[model samples]
Target: MTDTTAIDIPGYKQGTWVLDPAHSEVGFSVRHMMISKVRGAFGVKSATLVAPENPLETTVTAQVDATSLDTKDEGRDGHLRSADFFDVENHPTIDFVSTGVRIEGGDFLVDGDLTIRGVTKPVTFDFDFGGFGADPWGNYKAGATAKTVINREDFGLTWNAALETGGVLVGKDVTITLDLQGALQA
Candidate 1:
């Protein structure tokens, strides 16, 4: 039998928390023309995380502005915002809401509903808790790195083209990386 009794974990903290977007980054990369990879980042608008006094009972929710997507390339950015891709005009935001969390090995799996371009899909990300510390200002802070890969088409991002030499202009698989910092709001 498994112990359902809640126990305080050494590094776990409870209460409302805010994502420090200035210290966080949302990045993604996908194969371009099957020969090169294009990478980009979106500025996080707002995020919040809550724990029920125990890390095992936690909830996370985040929202990101779709228009904040930047690749450092104007042409590509515009293309990505067009109907061929994100269609930002219609869907102005991307969001994630955690449904479950499970620890495996030394890491965690964050299972959530990821919505993009009005399409929602179940996504699971591998997460690493980077411990907790206090800042000079006396605020508690924690960090985490999470990553996952998904088919862009699954989120309604179906833009692509056949290269003259071989494969399509854009690859279907997109790898997402989230480097996050959270401020304890307890």
Candidate 2:
């Protein structure tokens, strides 16, 4: 078992950190026809991190433009934006609000509610602190990588087609990974 004591992060500071969208990415992968994986990314609308002296008290809120989903295929992208999938016209954004942070098995975990297609569900992300540093321009920045998986049908993303060979066109589980870089607010 891993220790549950408070973690010590070197050079950690308490302040509001605004995500640099140009340096951040939200990507996902889902099984296609139970044979291969279809990977894509979404454009972040906004994300903010409120770090406290104690890392466990940190909070995060983020939004992703659902309409910005791109899978390198225009036809498939259009279908995902339709009512058959994300229904982006009605739910133009996917939102996430952190509730708490903790350490499990020596790994950081951020618990939060994820809303998609207007349906909300609790999800936990495996968080990794990528350390704090300053850029050549002297801007203090923080980086991290987080990931989680959820069932598509749990959030009203249930549209799928049965394959002739017996599987489904889309997998139920989707893996979401986030690479975030945030600049400290002055």
Candidate 3:
């Protein structure tokens, strides 16, 4: 087994960072039934990462376009945007604002409030440091990944169809993954 403590990169100066939307992705995966899994991604409209003097207390705020959701299948994507799910017409964006952040050994934890369909709930995402580097354009870039599992029904997204086999059409738990790339703002 690999030691996670060795994965951390050196911390940078305290400052604000802007997410590189072109390289960052917010995606999710969930069981389609009792067997298969379905996946989708939402476009990141804007994001800001606020690194405190002590990197461990970093803060992240992001807004995702609800209508920009895309999956491999158009029909399924349409359904996800409907009232049965996200109801894109009503909730035009999905937002997250971090409340607390901390680092334990080599791993980081980002605790935040996630709002969906007007319902707000506290959620924690495990953050993995991906180090900071310079881009080809001379921009200072930083990379990281965060993941968490949330119950769809907990946010008022309880719509579902009973499967003939005995399970529901949609899975209750959704695995959210975030691959983020940020550029420090001088």
In terms of TM-score, the best-performing candidate is 2
lDDT of 1 by residue, 26-82 (tens): 999999889889999998988999878666677899998889999999999999988
Evaluation by TM-score, superior candidate among 2 and 3: 2
Which is the winner by lDDT between candidate 1 and candidate 2?
Answer: 2
TM-score (all chains, Cα) for each model: 0.93, 0.96, 0.92
Report the error of model 2 at residue 13, Å: 0.8
Off by over 4 Å in 2: 1-5
What is the TM-score ranking, best to worst? 2, 1, 3
Model 3 per-residue lDDT tens digits across residues 33-111? 8799898999999999897666656788999988999988999999899998999999989999998776665567888
Report the lDDT tens digits of candidate 2 across residue range 108-130.
Answer: 89999999999999999998889
- Cα error of candidate 2 at position 106, Å: 0.4
Off by over 4 Å in 1: 1-9
Better of 1 and 2 by TM-score: 2
Q: What is the C-alpha lDDT of each candidate?
A: 0.88, 0.93, 0.87
Q: Rank the candidates by lDDT, best first.
A: 2, 1, 3
